[model samples]
Target: MVVTVFEAYAGLARRVLARPAWLGRTRLVAVDGPSGAGKTVFAARLADALARLGSGRPPVVNTDDLLDGWDDQLTFWPRLEESVLTPLRAGRAGAYHRYSWVRRRFLPRPVPVPAAPVLILEGVSVARAAVGPELSLAVFVTAPAALRLTRAVARDGPSILPELRRWHDGERAHFAADDTEARADLLVDGAPTLPHDPDRYYQRIARHPRPA
Candidate 1:
């Protein structure tokens, strides 16, 4: 099946630069959602779209690298602030190292993040679990449970099916009270999501502006 994608530089740019309150300047685009929601793929494509639309080309960051060894999961949250957020807020170039799961160590190479008009941070909690107040925009991607489960199993492997299920359960529980989804500026449908245009699989990322 041919996957559908939406990229409208003009429309996205206008929606992004919503008010005098914000700027295309130093924008942080955080793409959040559940696992198996295709956050990685969406981030890559969105970054490409934003680059084409905006004045300054934003750099992309994957929180996967900042992660602590699987043993101390999520410990890297503070590191993201120190390494990525601080420089972004300072309007300076920032550098960070990505963890190599295969090598079981962090690769020494640094991800040089420019303080462009925008920055794309794509991952599970690029916004939810981490601190990124400079986030000019935040998007949450969601899909049906069955579709997400199927995608997770297909991508990760059947052996991971149970583990992924548990992760989903935990995520739902965590987000329930926190209501990050409730506060989303946008909600993207991941798998088997639909649109007002029934024939269209790809919909412009839903735009619900934040009051701030």
Candidate 2:
């Protein structure tokens, strides 16, 4: 499954990275999935693919880093407005100090994201909830609950199973309620054993029309 996910995600990344890097144009690419759906791994692999395809650098802005905290967990709409959302809208790179949930606040030092042609934001609700329609692509990954639970337990250890299971259920429900899967520009399966290449995946999105 990991292999398949890697290739599929890498395929999407290649499409994104292949774009011309115009610092003047800021493009946001969001990857959304359920709690155990493997968005983070896909995002990184895709970023790498994009870099390889473009023969350039790929900068990433993860929602996890900017998140407020568990108190407002999965509620990234607010910080995004003041941080990534506003800056990107202004045609400026969004800059912000990454939040340290364990510390209950953001780090003092700020991180500068370039206003490059592509910016990857990967997380649970990134695609459906944040950033109004300027996305070059909105990807949604999915997999069976049984498979996801297996992956989660493997990654987080057995102790976190109960909590992870709950989170996964909640995320799945939210996506369904939001109709995100039906609206996804790209969807990838996370259960297969084959590698999901990026180039092919991204070309699919490039060919998809705008949501009506």
Candidate 3:
């Protein structure tokens, strides 16, 4: 009983549509996972699946954009709540400025987050208590630590491995305190996600595009 990606996505789409809208005008879906656990790709695929079902292409807001830098970590939640989540919760357009790693500063422009019927929020700490109550579906994605570290290094380079390791340590502590995995509506095995094509997962992260 192996489920293909399409099947899995279809199931996810069904679950999303079936659930009552939790956030004001939108069904907020959180894709919470460790680094290199395929959260980005899974969110994209799920968004695609939702669109195919006529749910309209939901916008994805990565927590990466909200972070000040590698050190900022989960500390940017207040900004996210005020700028994005709060507005969306009121059924208005949410807005947030994206942090630019290259520039070492947040872009002056505000990225518009529309009040959508469904929205995919992917990245670590996305499903923590502050935002969890507003989420219609909370998904926790996980892969083997060795594999995740390897994938992360392949994407971020070996020079930052120590930093990534430190980041993971903080994430581990946060997750323990938050019980993120325990609250997930779905726990996805990220290993098999995007099996055939891997580049789609890295393109957004590795290329470091200006945040939308």
Candidate 4:
């Protein structure tokens, strides 16, 4: 039967919580994909699902907040590692400066990453090998290239297409080098479906409780 995105995530979350700990006290979930592959929306739903599963609302850290601009794609990772991942790994609240696109600067306000049972890091390259071992479950979400491009342009305006294209090339090379998809614990088809068994997603999680 057709299920809402939230319903799909509920099934996925149930299985994630049923597994063994891979990231110590905090379950680190990496939702990595291309720019327009719906990572943000999916992460939000998954956080809600985790809360419904009695894990309390999982704090989500968007890599977008860590990026300076188009050139900073994977380069902003180290900052994320230091401010967010490191603290959370040590079972403490993580703090980071949030970047402002308009001001072209990182705001002084610190974004907090609560040490919860589950934490979602959503953005491109989030599942890269650099942080793989620290992740409990790594999910790779994707859609048709043409569809993703279209969605990106529509969301960011046509003027941003050139930047988007350049970013895509970098993402492609990074994923290739990291073999992200091959290493993923789960691959999500980030496309709207008609009537289909959403439980299949649950089954995938059941089979691969932890990313290899």
Best by lDDT: 3
User: Candidate 3 lDDT, tens digit per residue, 179-204?
Assistant: 99888877777786354444222221
| lDDT over C-alpha atoms for residue 85 of model 2 | 61
Residue-by-residue lDDT tens digits, candidate 1, 92-120? 77888888867878889887877676777
lDDT of 3 at 29: 96
lDDT value for model 1: 0.66
- Which residue runs of candidate 1 sit more than 4 Å off their true CA positions? 1-10, 17-25, 54-56, 71-73, 129-133, 192-212
* Top-down lDDT ranking: 3, 4, 2, 1
Cα RMSDs of all predictions?
Answer: 5.8, 5.6, 8.5, 5.1
Please give the ranking of all candidate structures by TM-score, highest first, separated by commas: 4, 3, 1, 2
- TM-score per model over all chains: 0.78, 0.75, 0.86, 0.86
The positional error of residue 171 in candidate 2, measured at the CA in angstroms, is 1.5
Q: Distance (Å) between predicted and true CA of 112, model 2? A: 1.8
TM-score of 4: 0.86
Better of 1 and 4 by TM-score: 4
- Give the per-residue Cα lDDT of candidate 4 at 58: 86
Worst 10 residues of 1 by lDDT: 193-202
What lDDT score is found at residue 204 in candidate 1? Answer: 44
